[model samples]
Target: MISKEIVVANKTGIHARPASMFVKTATQFKSNITVTKDGKTANGKSLITILSLQLVKGSNITISADGADAAEAVDTLIKMVESKFGEE
Candidate 1:
């Protein structure tokens, strides 16, 4: 398993569009991915679950993946968040 902590950098954080994009990217990996905020965790490949995290700009999140591609999955998602999901 691989995990990384990243701060949400987008203006709107993981809103609908970003959540969709996140789900899309997450689904491409075979790893089991999860997004964690505060004390709650959500399925990374599920839009509803991701949005339920209510992430906002500057919110801290931990992305974790468990599988053969765990490291890649965690890295990719971390980059996405750090890039502000192109919303900036």
Candidate 2:
């Protein structure tokens, strides 16, 4: 397993578009990915679960993955979050 923490930097946080982009990226990996916030965890590949996080600006989140490509999956997600899903 691998994990990385990041802060939500986008103005709108992980709203519909960003959550959709996140899900799209997550589904590409063979690893099982999860996003966590304040002890709550969600399947990274599911749009609904991610939206449920209600991530707002400055929210702290952890992206984690397990399986063959765990490290890659975590890194990719960390980058995506750090990039603000390109919304900024």
Candidate 3:
């Protein structure tokens, strides 16, 4: 398993569109992806699960992945978070 932490930089955090985008990205890999915040864990490939976390701006989240593409999954997720989910 591989894990990396990132801070939400988007103004709206991971709501609606961003959550959809995140879930889409996560589903691209074969690895099992999970995200955690404040002790709450959610499946990265599920919009409902991600949205349930209520990750607001400045919230710290850990992205973890386990499987053949674990490292790539975690790294890509970190990049997505760092990129503010492309919200600018």
Which candidate number has the best lDDT? 3
Candidate 2 has its poorest 10 consecutive residues by lDDT at 79-88
lDDT rank, highest first? 3, 2, 1
For all candidates, the clash counts are: 0, 0, 0
What lDDT is obtained when candidate 1 is compared to the true structure? 0.93
Look at candidate 1 and give me any clashing residue pairs: none
Residue pairs in steric clash, candidate 3? none
Q: Tell me each candidate's RMSD, in Å, in order.
A: 0.6, 0.6, 0.6
- Candidate 3 stretches greater than 4 Å from native: none
- Per-residue C-alpha lDDT of model 3 across residues 1-88, encoded as one tens digit per residue: 9999889998988998989988999999999999999999999999999999999999999999999999999998899889887789
How many Å off is the CA of 34 in candidate 3? 0.3
Candidate 2 lDDT over 1-88, as tens digits, reads 8988899998988899999999999999999999999999999999999999999999999999999999998998888888988877
**How much lDDT does each candidate structure score?**
0.93, 0.93, 0.94
Error of 1 at 59 (Å): 0.7
